[model samples]
Structures are given as structure tokens and as C-alpha cells.
Target: MPRENSFSDSEGRSLTPDPEDEIHYEEPAAEAASPTYSIRTPWSPTGHTVPHPFSASRRSLHSRAPHPIPGWQNLTPKEKFRITVRRVMAMHRGASILTTGGRVGAEPGVDPRRASADALYSHISQDCVIEVVDYSAVRSSFGRMTNKEFVNFMGDKSASQREPWVKVRWINIGGMSWDVIKAVSIKYNLHPLALEDVFHGHKQNRSKADYYSRHLFLRILCHELGDPDYSPSGHSAAQGSTLTGEPRSMSPEPMRDEDRLNGVKGGDVDEEKTMYGTPPTSRQSTTKRRRNPLLPTNRRDVDGMPKASNSASNLARLLKREGDVKDARKERQVEEVSIEALKQGERVNVKVSPMFLFLFRDGTVISIHPEPDLDFTVPITQRLRSRDTVLRTSADPSLLVHALLDLIVDRSLQVIDEYHTKINKFERRILLKPKMRTVRELHILSGDLILHKRTLEPIKTLIYGLRRYDVDRCAALIDMSDPANANTKVVGFMSHKSKIYLADVFDHMEYILTSLDMFTSISENLIDYTFNLASYEMNEVMRRLTLATIIFLPLTLLTGYFGMNFEAMWSVQNNSDWLFWKIAIPLMIFIIPVFMYSDLTRVFHFIQKKMVTKQAVKQYKRA
Candidate 1:
């Protein structure tokens, strides 16, 4: 087979862009097999053809190249870069669609154009719901958006700038329809890699923070009680910012003009400064807080007990009464309630979901929940509505990020606590009367602890990345313009105020890891105990059986001897009933005492010990 002069369309036309036809719609070999030619994009390095819903093929990026279009070598670098970017996006989109099998295909009876339009952002799930929260110091707006409103809400059709005062715009999607993913992707100019991680990266149980050109792409796995499989692929692009070094959004590409208007809807905006000056209620305050004030304090009382305070200050008498323990007692009570709430909750069916968080410089946060229908951030919504939260007055997205992570960590603690409680029950059962079923359940619980630990371990990296400014590889950005905060340090995704919250999140992560370790240790010990108790019980049973067999052997011998024929057998048989007892009793008494006297004493001791209970077993558990 001889090579032709140049590549050509298998059809009549030449593959080379004729001076007359600089662009062609002919499919490359990779796409020729697909029947959707009309809507299919052409394979041109120049990218002259229409955009398909995804890429031309699912080929690996490193694989051997297909034939490049003629004149490709002469093309300028800029054109080549454009071509490469498009190719990358197309590849990711194609792979994601194939894996998700989203509703990107044309409907049977619908017009191809309409179908394509709908499929353009078709990643949103059928059950998907949209939530948007716009907040600032003075007021906040939180509500839902209709799934069908994407075009008007985020597409090129709606061009408006979000209010500068609306410090952060949080758009959360509970379900995914490929359409929604694309629509939102375009709306926020989400990085292709981020979108890939957001939707297709569920298998990755580890948490990661990738800083791109225009946004922070943070992906973390959350479980009800956890898959620990994680391959961290982290990259931090050095993004230039304005004066004083504020980190800019690291979106993969610049968003379209219309996307600039992404913000919460303005309907019935219940602007609440409703006592926004007051601190949060005790319950809300204690929630997500790692430290338990209920624990013994550092101060010692006159009685040498660790108490809330050792002495009241002179100002305390002026404020109220000296040595007022009421306030401390009330705080302790609140802490107890909050801590209890964290540990005790209705049971949850175990599940692990990857929650994707996209934070932009302008305080726009886009979060995609793994389960499309369930909104795990409902508490965030409620607190955003309440004016009493410091969160309500914040302009930084990092604060919101901290809040969300803290919530997840707290929920994880609750789930872990449940496992702890379950294992404790199994341990107690094994201690008393070990059962096979309990051992099996302990095995499962042990596995769950391992999984949860794996899933949560990566969060350590995530929190560290936030606390340190290393995500962007930039030093802490300080704005000396604010005289008070001039010396304050803003690191990575965390603002100075939010730094405390991030610290709390870090503390919570540590607590979680420690609890998992402790629980896992308990689980292993219980399993060992179960086996030991089972072996001891089996040994005791076998010993009793052997002793009984040995003690009764002599009586069995007497009976056997009498049954055998003998010289006086007829005479003995005639009078044997009484004679048999007299001979059998003496032999039995002698043999039983000689062979089993110790066992009888032991049995009697055991019975007597049971008769007089020394004391009740102390159960160190919640009343």
C-alpha cells in the first residue's frame, strides 16, 4: 500500500483545507463511527467546526496522535494553544459524560438544536435543586433557584454585576444533571479539572485543595459514619492579585460577561439586622466548637476541685454579685447540651459523598453536594438567615468554608461516636457471654472505623493547606489600609478572622482522627477478647466432660461385670437387685471420691460464691 500525497476525506473532498474551503465538517477517523454527525464537532486543529456537547473521542492524551490537519505546522503558537485548551476541555467533558451517562443525548422526537441546547448543561440531575445565598455584614439573602432558570439566571442571556456589598454568593446544587454542571461551569468558569473532581472523583476518598488561576478548587469526602482510597493530585498556580496581595479567583478560564452577574435572587429579601449585634445562642455557639467548656477548667477552687473560677474579680461585684457561679454553670449546661447533640443523634445509614467547594476571590462559593436531592448544608442556610451569627457579618468566603468543614467534622464526630457506642456494647457482650453474632458485628464495625479513618485522614492536608498560605505559594497578604488589621495575616483561602475558624476545623480533624484511632484499638482488643473468651469457655466445657467420663467409668465397669456370666450367676440373679446396690454403692463412693473429689469441692465453692454476692459490677457508663 503506497501513501497518498496528503490526508483526504474518505469522501470526495480532500482532508487538506483547500484555499477555497479553509474549514471542513468531515469527521476524523475517531468520530466517523458515531452516527451523530450533524451535531458532532469536526476534528480541526484550527477548531473551525461547531462545538459538540463534549470532545471528539475518549482517547488518552498520551496516546499516539491521529493525523494532524494539513498546514498545522505553519500555524502560530496562539492558535495552537487555543486548539490545545479546547482539546483538553473536550477530553474531560467527554470522559465525564461517558462515566456519568448524563442526559446529554438528543431526545428521540425533539429538534436536535433544542436537544443540544438542553444537553449543553445537562449534567444536573432530575432531582437537582439549586440554592443560592448572598450575604454581607448588614443583611443576607438565601433562597432556591429553579433548575429551568439556568439560561436566564447564569447564561449569556443575563448580563449584570453582582452587588459589591453582597460579600459572598454561595450557589449550591444538591443534584447533578450534566446540564447544570456545564451551565454552572460556564457561569463560574470552573476549572475543567475541578469539575472532573467534583463530579467524577467520588472514588477519591482523600481531601485536596488545588489553587488554579482564578479560584480555589477544594474537594473533600464526607461520610455518614468512609472509602479511604485517595490519590492526591495537587497543584498551586501562582496567581497575581491587586495591591496588598489579595488572592484572585483561580477559575480555569475567564468567565463570560453574563456569568459575572451570578448572585442570589432579590425576591422577598428579608433583610435582617435582627439583633445582629448579639452573639450566637449557646447551642449554635457550641456547635462546631472543638473545645468543651464543660470539661474541668484550669482554675482550682478552695475545695481543690477544678472549677470554672477560683475567685471572682472585684469588677464582678459591680457587674452583679461576687463569686457568681450561675453564669459559669449556665455555660457548662449549654456546653453539655451541645456536646451531647454532637455525640447522640438519630442513626444515619452509612454513606460517603464527595463535597466540592469552589471559592472565588469575590467571595463567591459554589458547592456541589454528592447526593443531588439531600441538602446537608441546611444548617448553614438557617444560620445565614439568622442575623445573630458572626458568619452573617463576614465578607470572606473562607469563613463560609470553615463553617462548612466544621459542620462536616462535627457530623463525622457524631457518626464516629455511634460506632464507639456500638463497639462498647459488643465489648460488654463479649465480656459477659461472647456470641458469634456479636463478633461478626464487631468485625463489621472495625471495618467501618478503618474506612472512616481513611476517608477523614486527607482532611488534615486540606486544613493545613488553608491555614498555611501554601495553596497559592504566596506569603500572607496584608492590607495596611485597615489600620487595625494592618498587622493581621491572611493566609491562603483563610482571612485573618476566619483563621480562628480554620484552627477550630483543624482541631476537630485531630479529634476525629484520635477518636477513630481509639475506637479502632478498642475494636481490635474486643475481637481478641472475644476469641480468648471463646477458647476459655470451650476448654472449660471439654474439661467437665472428661472428668465426668473418668468418674463414671468405675460404675459402668460394675454394671458390665454383673451382666457377664459367672459360676454363681443364677443364684445372684435371683437375689441380684439388693446385692447389686450394696456392691455398686461402695465402689461408686470410693471411685467418685478418689477420682472427682476436687471437682466436687470446686463446684460447691462456685455455688457458695454465687450465694453471697460481694458487690455489684461497677458500670462506668452514661446514666
Candidate 2:
């Protein structure tokens, strides 16, 4: 090979010569077998020579090297928008198509006020329905109210037609509606960002709690019933009319919302208050409570004993009370309902869903049930209907929040129980007869557990945050300004009592997480065990095949030798009748194995011992 001379510019900088600038001719060696030409011309139809379009010496300009092109800047706005929509649709094939509106996918810290109400409403109306419940605690008058009525009562300080005072009010909404949610947001002065979370219930499926200046927003995830055959005895047929167009199953005296709305009678509303338990009718005084002023203040009557009042009148009253109690006791029959009914409902196999609960500082709870038809808080409703329940007696809205949290945790435990049962069944199957289907089911169950973990961890963190604030002490509050809460602020009117109760929920969530972790490990181990079992079975099959091959190998050879056509064997060639005896002799070769069975066993034992002795000698030498 010969080196080519380099070309340079006047500045002495090296420059590569262009193909067009270079003059080239084929060498003698290149021309021997194949000739090289810079251009090849062809004869035209008229016998005229035509110039070649491409020269053989020139390199192709179409290189594989990448070149930059102006893309987005060159596209029109409409074209860009169309392309974006197409890409989004392609990516979301089988996913819910959400309208781009109202901070739907906005980055953190984006101003929610910049979001349009119409956009939010449009997004929510697709799968949401609104329902509200309002009750006056002091007057003990309860009614199902609409959005307008709820807003009116909550917004107005002078609207006391049903009750002179309202200690606690609850507004329960079923399903999600952007417009209705916005209305409630405005009326209650809810945090804008928190309000944004209200519309993202099922899709996000995240459990979290955010506290604002006026309310605490809690998202709880719940799985449906656990047991397939579980049923509660004497299950209440109807939940009292907490909403209109629903069946009313009150105790005859409770006020209906229709009566209050129609202005039927003020007296009816007053009667509704008495239904909640008002000083026991004619037997009790209107101005008196359960405690009597004449009784000794330091002592209370117990076990049918009179109070130490040192008065004959007090003694007689106590005795009369005891007699009445004895008569009531004699007629009373013990009604037993399983605790399981209080915890697990009839529908245990339903899918898991999220619930949005808003607890206000003013003792108003606004809950959004994603499943409009099924109310998971039926137990709470049952408690609320009875006069002696703490929910009715205390008139604390936070108690309702606690009850709901308890319900959510209990439901999670039930779901865990179901998983535990499934895990046990899978373990048994794996031990007895491992299969691919069982392993697949375990893998799927693990995924569900991970989903539940995602939901519970956030809830656990929120509850811990509330616990740190010590909501009950009121001396300290969660500093919303903390850098940690940058994504969502917790500066609002919070029920300290509710925060205290949420601690228990935090503990329950931790336990559930631990259970999930265990179940996940079990699933992973089961998969590994399945593979191990398969490998073991394969080895067992190979061992059996190898043993059979060793035992029958000699027999196979003997039969092949006897079946040969070599007529040189003396006895067989001399006598044709002896062929049967010859064949029998070859067949009798199998008798050797039967004769050596005991001897082969001894030989195997002797060999194994010798190998062990050799291994021990090697170890001894190394030592």
C-alpha cells in the first residue's frame, strides 16, 4: 500500500480533498479482473450517447448520520394540538379519557383559582351524583336537605325555625359532582387544592388526609365484605330518611325534611326533637334531668340501694325506681347479635373503593360515598337512630368521623382475613401439589396487596401528622407553613378530638401494612417453592429412567445376539429343533439379575463405604 499525500490550506491547516476535486484513474492491478470507471454512458434509442447520471467515483450523499430538523417551532398551533391529542389518546387506550381542565394534571403549587369552574364541573358530572344530610342537634330535628337548603342553613346564623340551636350538622353526599362539590366548597370555605382532590376519587384510589384552615379532608380506601356466606340476622330493612325520594323508616315521631320544607307545622318539628329523648315524657319533669337536686350530691344510688340523702321521700323514690327497673328487667329478653355483624356486612365480596370524608371544625361532616347505592356506614346510621348511642347523646361530629375511621379499618382487617384464608389455601396446595395456576393467583394477590399498601401508607402518614399536632391539646397545631407540607397545606379548622381518634386508625394501618408485607413474602416464597418442586420432580423422573436402563441393558444385548442370522453356531446349525432351546437360553439371561439381586445390594453397599473411606483419607491427608 502507498500513502496518499495530504492537502492543506494557505494557513497550513490540513483539509480533506473533495471527491470532485480529485482526478482518479484505475491502476493495472485494479483493471486485471474488474475495471473501474468514473462514469458509464449508455447509447440512446437514436444511437446517441447519453451522459451518466451518477459517477462511480463519487460517494453516496445519503448518509446514515442523524441531522437535526426544526420540529415543534415549525408546526402550527392547531397541528401541534392535534398531534398532542392523538398521542394522549394512544397512550390512554383503555383508560378513562379525562378532559384537560381545572388543574386535573397540574403540577404541584399551581394556583387552583386559575382553574375554571365549568371545566371542573364538566369533568365531575360524568360519573358523580350529589346527596346531602342535615340535622339540628339541639332541637334533635333531622331532615334530608338539598344543596341549596344545606348552604342556606350553614350560611345563615338566624335560620333557627327547626331548632333554637344547632350543635352539630352532617352533610352526607353520595357520589361526586363537580358543581355540587364546588358549591359545598364555597359554602364551607374549603381549601381549593383539597377541593380539587374531591373530584379525583376512584381514579387516584389514594388514601390521604389533608387539613385546611376550616376543615380536614380524609380519603379512606375500603374493601367490600370478606366472607362469601356471611349474613347479619335481623338486618334493618331501611335506613331512616336521610334523603328525599328514599324510604322513611323513622320511629313515627322523627321529623321529615318534606314537612320542614313545606312549612307543614312548627309543632311537628318540635315533636321530632322529643323523639331523640326529652326527659322521659310524663313520668319525668320537663325541667329535670336524670340527676335530682334533692339527692345527696356526694353519693349515688346503686344496685337498687337508696341514695344517702337522709330523707324518707328520697328513699321512697329510690324504692319505686327499683321496683320499676325490676318489672322492666322481668319483661326484657336478651337479644344477641354477633360482633361480626357490627364489623363485617352482608356484601363482603364487593370490590374495593375510596371514600372522601370532610370533617369541619364546626362539627359538620361531609362524606362523599363513591358507591351511591351502597352505604358502608350503615352501622353508624343504626347507632345514630338510637337515642342512647354516644353519637346522639354527645352531639359531637368528630365521633362520626371516628366511627367512620373505625369502619374503614375494620373493613381492611376483614379484607386481610380473606387474604389470609387464600394464602393458607395456596400454601396447602403448594405443599400437596404445586401448580402454575396457584402461583399465578398468588402473584395477582400480591399486586392487590401492593395497591392497598399504596392507599394505606399515605393515610398512615397523615394520621401521624395529625397526631403530632396533638389536636386535643389545642396548645399546638400542625404548622401548615412547614416545608414538609409543600404539596398540600394543613392549615385549617380541625377537630382536635377527631385527630386524637385518628391515632388509633394510624396504628391499625401500620398493622395492616405489616400483614401485607407478610403476605407478599409468602407469595414470593410460594413461587420459588413451586419451581423447586418442579425441579425435584424432574430429577426424580430422571433417576427412575436411569435405573431401569441399567437393569435391562444386558438383557437387551443378549436378545440382539441370539436374534442374529449368523448360521455358524455349531449346535444351532446341526439341529434345527434346537433353535427353540437356543432362544430360551438367551431369554434365560434375565435370570442372572434375579440371582444377583442380593449380591448387587451388597456390592453397592461395599462401593459406597469404599468411596466414603477414600474421601475421609483425602481429608485426613489435607489436614
Q: Which prediction has the highest lDDT against the true structure? A: 1
Candidate 2: deviation at residue 99, Å?
A: 15
TM-score of 1: 0.53
Provide the lowest-lDDT 10-residue window in model 1.
283-292
lDDT of 2 by residue, 1-623 (tens): 11122222234322221234222212233211111011223323334432221111111134333222125455457644644453333222201111111112233221122212221132232233343434444335445554334433433435523243666666666655433455466456566556545543343356776655567778776665623543322123242212111111210111223432233244332211221133322211111010001122122322224444333344455457546855765554222244333334212253455678888766678887755443676787667767677667777777787778778888878878888888888899999988887776777666667766776667677667666753432323445477775565333344566666777887888988899899989988999999998999899999678667656666676566666788587645776756655655665566656756786899999999999999999999999
For each candidate, the alpha-carbon lDDT, in order, equals 0.55, 0.50
Steric collisions counted per model: 23, 8
State the displacement of the C-alpha of residue 110, model 2, in Å, after optimal TM-score superposition: 10
**Could you estimate the TM-score for every candidate?**
0.53, 0.50
Clashes of 1: 23
